[model samples]
Target: MAKKLFMFEKPLGMRDTLPFLYELKKQVRSVMAEEIERWGYEFIETPTLEYYETVGAASAIADHRLFKLLDQQGHTLVLRPDMTAPIARVAASRLYEDGNPLRLAYNANVFRAQQREGGRPAEFEQIGVELIGDGTVAADAEVISLMVALLKRVGLDRFSVAVGHIGYVNALFLEILGNEERASVLRRFLYEKNYVGYREHVKSWPLSSIDQKRLLDLLSLRGGTDVIEQAKTLVTSEEGRRAADELAALMAALWTYGVAEAVKLDMALVSHMSYYTGILFDVYAEQVGFPIGNGGRYDDLLAKFSRPAPATGFGLRVDRLVEAIGETDVRGDIECIVFSQERLAEAVELAEAKRAEGKRVVLQHIAGIRDIDAYSQRYRSIVYLLGRGGQ
Candidate 1:
């Protein structure tokens, strides 16, 4: 029988990032954490594994996408697909009992079994903030403004935070003489950005001609602040009008936050987070094909765990961020290398002295090397003669 070969491979949707890229991610995290702290968000963390019954109790998407497994005691557990639900659980249970209106920050990894639409990655490093107990349009604006500031800190100048309201589509869905379940079928198509399916479904489904036209127009309508005024004319529901008003107010506030230039009003932004009761957003940057960050308001989720309170937040994709803004490489200065074994101890002492003085030193041993010049070039280090006659 032929001998079999051994091969190594990383699991699909995961890979080891090289050192330069790894360091670059660290730099990005440092900048983001500094900004998060400056904004008064106290850092917090959640377990990677949680009871399936905890996070899955609210939304179908969350229930299905979790990386599920049985724990040691045979309890259903899962690798969290997103932090929002887990944070909500914590807020309703622990934070709510202790304090109110938490401005919490966290750095975490979210694992999802399925890939997202438009080639979104499966595993991601998520850095985020949540303002629990504050539900006003101001709270919503603060999240978006901070997103702008964070992107600028990371050297990403060309980007836009697309402000949206889930109520925009939900309002229309209610008006079309269909139950939410029926309307959800259409909403799913929109979330997938499946324009053909959306249009065909709308055409065959029972809807007033005027409502159909307005919904289509709403789908296509995305622009600067003026688009809010356009939405006021097109959407009829009180909820829809209030959503537009709230969006306009939030944009005005973003101006005060000095990030209005980065704000874009996209009325069609239907979020995957089902519990979002109000403003929702997606951050896009130039040279990157997909969203680098996402956030919104979800008031209903916390109620499922312990208490009901208004909350809004966002998460930035560290992997996608470095992909958009390429990683940085750190170069070292001229390193001092000592080759002779006899000189090794002296070289180490000298290297320590230099290191104490804040210089980079490389100590190496070479026994047979005759041409020191070749070794210097090969190691890219300066050889300091200490133990030989040159000493």
Candidate 2:
């Protein structure tokens, strides 16, 4: 009997990134790392699989959309759907004794079970950073400015960083509704940018005319620092005032850092993650429909690890970022593609020498002219024939 040919297929909603996409991913990560290192943030890594309960506390991943399984000990484990939760676990268990304001970064693949409508893949790479132990406006400013710098470094020259305070939105809901469940529902509506749904959700509430006006006003809050003045009028609670003040200070600091032009304010902006306790934000490029990166202060996340330290972070979806940047045909400048049949050793030595001096070299064996030209056109490689001596 003949043996059957074996082939592998990727799971649903997951894909094997091809070579061009992989190169684009690498470039995006390199740009992110360079920008992060400029801000004195160090790199770190955590396990891909985590205790189910640890991530279960986060509303972002608590849902069954996580890919879960049982461990050898029969304990539930989950492939992390996001990076921040794992980073929080790491900070609590490993770096708990470290000094204040630890800045750490990571680049890793995260897995999630897509609900089919989210239009996102189940497995994707996230390049992100965490700032722990500091919750001051200065820290927020530093992180935001670093984000701006990173985006600029990555060739996203026409992007904007839309900043908001979750506290402001939470405070408004708490003051008007005083019901967590109702507030969560409204938050979901706002997060989806379903202004119509938000209106419908609030219609049944017994909010006063003033509260109704305030809520409606928030939906239109977008622009520069001037938007904060409007935010103050929309939020009546003391907590709301504090959130606005923090945003004001953050805007001022960004101006001082010469990044104000790249920053914008959005009072109604809400993060999908419910743990964010303070400033929340997302970066948007004119060319993309969704955010290229997002993050916010999750002062309460570390508490889940039993340490209760304040923390903030942001992450770039490297794939989406590269897509926003558009693919470049970087293979066009290839100056040499050395071909060898009998002189493999010599070809390899010459290729290595050229590569060491920063030259692009491809060493391969070709049998005929047609094959050589085909390979050259495929890779946009320049052909160099190696014969007996120098012909």
Instruction: Give the candidate number with the greatest TM-score.
Output: 2
RMSD of each candidate?
3.4, 3.0
Enumerate residue pairs that collide in model 1: none
Model 1, 172-205: lDDT tens digits are 6776645788678877887888878888887887
Give the whole-model CA lDDT for all candidates, comma-separated: 0.80, 0.82
Worst 10 residues of 1 by lDDT: 1-10
> Could you tell me the TM-score of candidate 2?
0.89
Residue lDDT tens for model 2, 265-374? 98988866476789988898867888888888888888888888888888888878887888786433345556657677777777788889887666666654456555
Off by over 4 Å in 2: 1-8, 115-119, 179-181, 332-345, 367-370, 378-387
Off by over 4 Å in 1: 1-7, 56-64, 115-121, 331-336, 357-362, 367-386, 389-391
Pairs of colliding residues, candidate 2: none
What is the alpha-carbon lDDT of model 1 when measured against the actual structure?
A: 0.80
Candidate 2: Cα lDDT at 221:
93
Q: TM-score of each candidate? A: 0.87, 0.89
